[model samples]
Target: MRYLVAALLLASLPVFAQTVAKPMNDPKTDTFLRQFAETRRFMSGRPTKPRITPDEKTVLFLRAQPTSATQTLFAFDVATGETKELLTPEILLRGAEETLTVEEQARRERMRVSAKGFTGYDLSDDGQRILVSLSGKLYVFERATGKVLELKTGPGVIDPHFSPDGKQVAYVRGHDVYRLELATNTEKRVTQGGTEAKTHGLAEFVAQEEMRRYSGFWWSPEAKHLAYTESDTTGVEKLTIVDVMRPERGGNTFPYPRPGKANAVVRLGIIPIAGGKTVWVDWDAKKYPYVATVTWKKGGPLTVLVQNRTQTEQQLLSVDAATGKTRLLLTEKDDAWLNLDQDFPRWLEDGSGFLWYTERNGGPEVELRKPDGSLAQSWVKPAAGFFGLARYVDADRTLYFYGDPNPTQSYLWRVRDGGAPEKLSTGTQGPAHEQFAHVAKSGGLSVATTQTATTMPRFVVLRSDGTRVGELPSVAVEPPFAPNAQFFQVGKEGFHASVLRPRNAKPGVKLPVVIKVYAGPTTTVVRHSMAENLLNQWMADKGFLVVKFDGRGTPLRTAAWERTVKYDFATATLDDQIAALKALAEKVPEVDLARVGIEGWSFGGYMAALAVLKRPDFFKAAVSGAPVVDWLDYDTHYTERYLGLPQEHPEAYEKSSLLTYAKDESKPMRPLLLIHGTADDNVYFFHTLKLSDALFRAGKPHDLLPLSGLTHMVPDPLVTQRQYEWVLGYFQKHL
Candidate 1:
């Protein structure tokens, strides 16, 4: 009954609003957008993929080249504190332009990697040779000689990993897995019978996008065998993406399963690197169709985590290396659905036991379990927090972890065997907000990154005694304007929210408000990192107070907080946004609740559309980008997990659909602007078009703008700059 009657009734409805606004010339806005091009990235100087050598003599990381959006590999000498460039993308490619395959492009999209050159690499066990892929060709760089050798491998090769002994490399090509002998320069096909409809050693669409399981293969400890996934996607539905601007290029069709549709059938198998018979792991595929995680560590049995169709039940099974026989080691069942942790089910150095994280006590806690699946000890006591273990220091009998006691704030801590956990990061400088620390098991050396809403991320090396060794140089050009975000916990639920005021606003003046949100399941909006809110800060500077909060449905908190949206996705997510807004507005005098707006993309887009259509009194104007109008059009794993099967729980789908509200002629018609890319395959472009069709049938008015070739992600800097300007003008004109 919330949106039964809108503020702009049928009689008061105005003419269709303009879809495009004139570009405004603002110095501050121009400066902010220019940073994206000048820095080559929003937050430049960020050291990525920092790995300590086994000898602890050097640390290897990737840094952006100042002139171009490409990464160069650099090695930092631990003893001298001097950094030296090992390989530059220009020298490695020999000035040849890099060409990516379709598979590579999709992987980059899922990872949100817009930069180029040496995105990832793997070092050998002895740290002698580093294996990397450039433009679908394999390359090996010798650390001692500082020489790069590009092998004559064919195109479309991806995810090449060096064997444990560093004698061979395993990679995927044309849906099949292959092994290359480094000594003789001989190549052997490890697994055969792969087609376009089915693939081996490659993750399915849902696994990479939703489940966060990027790699589809696991290597055994002795380097003699490999475990990989074979996904048969023939059963899944197909969605076509067309480049309407070029009619000659018809469309590309791919298997994209919708809600209540068949998902790709996945099977796990064990293969020998020496070319032998394939051993398929046995499991109840009908009951558990989703493979969530796989782990194969030295001296331990191969383990896999599988979940049911509804994701309500998960089984952790141990696979025999030789026979591929599976035995259920542990099983977890929840009334709603199981949530996956980033780091869990990790084996100890001795391989006698492992660490398992569970929410049986209402929040996530670490528990040590023996290989026989018996409880050993409570490694980390039950607390209202989420924990992700970074490394286990077997010598000191301690495990280093990063967790958040409060959902919005994060810190690093160490938990010893039979001892209470001790906090290591105090955030003394400002707020430990989003701090991450990684410890090296060999040398007792660690690295930590600290950042806040007003602070740029900085990396520092630390000794075992928590003494700072030296800070690594960051090439990031910090923004000229100081961020004005104030963190607060509001309402009876203690919802975490950040409010950003206009940089030049006076203390007594109130400004119009905008709520930018992605109130989807398992996504958080309230993080301590400054980079997470740069766009919001820029929006705040445009004479609007920006507010973002993590509602009941999002993750990073207790299990109970997330369970509020079970079978009720629309109600809890929308209600919490409204409650947090009203509570924060009452507490802060700068928030003008009378003139409010909402904007978001993807899940946030859905929430934006839902806000105006359902609660017009609160959200006067909205801009929805690639919104999911109907639950029936969404994918299987994500939608069915939260709302249940469409057939079994039809009411849940009806309650979550925006089409129902659009067809209701009595409901108010607010100023809604819909934006989508015609080539958005993840959330298809038809979602907005279908909703527009419904509005037209109801004789309602709205605005629609479609980008020509953009996908679900806005990778082009110009496109992102224009998008912000368009949104700013729309809000200014409407609010």
Candidate 2:
């Protein structure tokens, strides 16, 4: 009788111990656990903007530098590793007063002056004068005297360049090319008859954004002539985006062409500096698409790269500058569209031939071709890596380039101009990032390095043989967070998973999970770099597991992975995400799948809404802000890329729409909260209005928060705080 009673007491004691396990927010075991509101308030500090100096050695970035409401730029020296004040508050105020008129001055006093520094500046070949643009006006400053000279005052002055002799400066003004002679103080119009409707010597919207060619003019080596492109937008389609600033007043429209649409026509022309007629380069515009990049050969014919609208076929053509007779120097084609290398092909000093990059055999390979049309014996074959262009081919026939032979990391590579390539810098083992700087006359390379998962970019100078000459000063990041937070990867079935355990996480404690997603076609949410991303860190600090992964349609990857959702964008990508979630649930036992929630912005918001509507079994709640519920609601350029034409593919568009899938409201789906800005031009406020109406008609429960007077990219502090509050509150309630 005594043994039986002891055995029963021991069994009952084990059961009682399981029931008394500490709660997630216990005072003893979970002393660091802060309330969601408190955590959010702690994280909602002032915003920080990054600034890089012209020299690339010092990073004059802002972190809480509050001399004023807007950011203030500081100066840092890499050599001494010291920082000093460069742009004083008095200087900024004076500059503001000089630029603004009397009526504008009163209004500007009330408005915060944001820091708008130099985008790109040029030092004169003699290094005596510096040319910089401040708010579209070109200002020349003497290096030693610090005196400012207004060279050419205009609204659209861009891409200003100085002649080799530093006697003349050329810049783009009002869609036309202009040359300023410093000696005579006279400005001459090189190209004429530019209008708002038609451009004469400047690139159009598509050429600038897609091809990455900002300047349309280039000066010859002798400085005696200028080569430029004139883009004609007479036949291109125009897109009008409504301005939500003033609801009573309608918006303005601009010309924008999408894929397979009629793009602006481009023509190359050369003008002599001595004042002559603009001679059009002879090329069959109908048969061969216009040139994207134009370069003059040293004492030889001019070279131009031409590609079709589809971008599958490419040709490097050499044209006679005197007569405009063109002959194809090299031709390459691919099954998919080829990326046009617009980095101004460098001409060897000898003028025998030039080097070109081709991905014809899968990856970028170097090809040395002669002046006529034959390939030189010296050529770099394709390797199992990516190759990028670096400036200057030295006298020893050594070509410099940079790449990551391994997809996981990047490094610089130097190839003997005629032979095989050799790795110059061995990057950090995991997720290394590198960027090459502007080549110096001394024949050395300036390189920037950042370890894996670091946001702060550091610079270093290296000799031609890959030896480090000097190290630049490091940029500062706030709060001193851990170097390694978390990284995610999609499984074999394409599901999302990330490891976000705290630095001192307990051995066996289940954590709530939050999925931060931006499942869009144009941009990917996941990348191996140091970024102070708001959502990822906010939830991670609140003891929630975070996960982010690319669906099928994100850009900057292989075409096969990107084009998988040709006509079916949402469905295919969503399946991969759902698969990822299921795999993560099986692997991570500490993940509380029952408390899973999803949140996103813009296109990501659309995915969050679909996750609850389509796969309610996986997520408990979702928060979507500025989502595009329907394809037809967006602009023509972005939507037409994946779905072809709306008239032809109405069914595909309908299937992809979230409104069509909102029929089954009786299921045990997660709660949804939709947020939008009334004045969003990119996604438009109508998206939420239409979506809300559909949800109401289907008898679905949703929360709608409308932000007034906010644009597509919301920068308002109050609006951002409210947005974060609404999202965090929704997840806490449901999850």
Candidate 1 C-alpha RMSD relative to the actual structure: 4.5
lDDT of 1 by residue, 405-499 (tens): 77777777777784777766533476655456667766378777777777777777777677777766667677766677888999998899999
Global CA lDDT of candidate 2, please? 0.60
Give one digit per residue, the lDDT tens place, for model 2 in 1-735: 232233224223111001111123333543222322223322222223223333444433332232223333344454565765433333534556324222122112123222334333566766566665554566676745756677754565656898767788887777788888987778888888877667666666555544556667878777888888888878777654443335466654545564445667888888887657987888777755646677774545678888765455767787766677788777777654555666545567787766776655545566776767576754556553544576555466666666554433456666675666676653345565554443443344445444455443445555566666554343232334533455545578453344555445565677777777776665565545444343455556656677776766654344456666666657877787767766776666767877778888888889888888887888888888888888866544346546656677787688888888676677654588777766554576667767766766676756666666665555555556556655665666676
TM-score of 2: 0.76
- Least accurate 10 contiguous residues by lDDT in model 2: 13-22
lDDT of model 1 at residue 599? 94
Models 1 onward score TM values of: 0.95, 0.76
What lDDT does the true structure give each of the candidates?
A: 0.80, 0.60
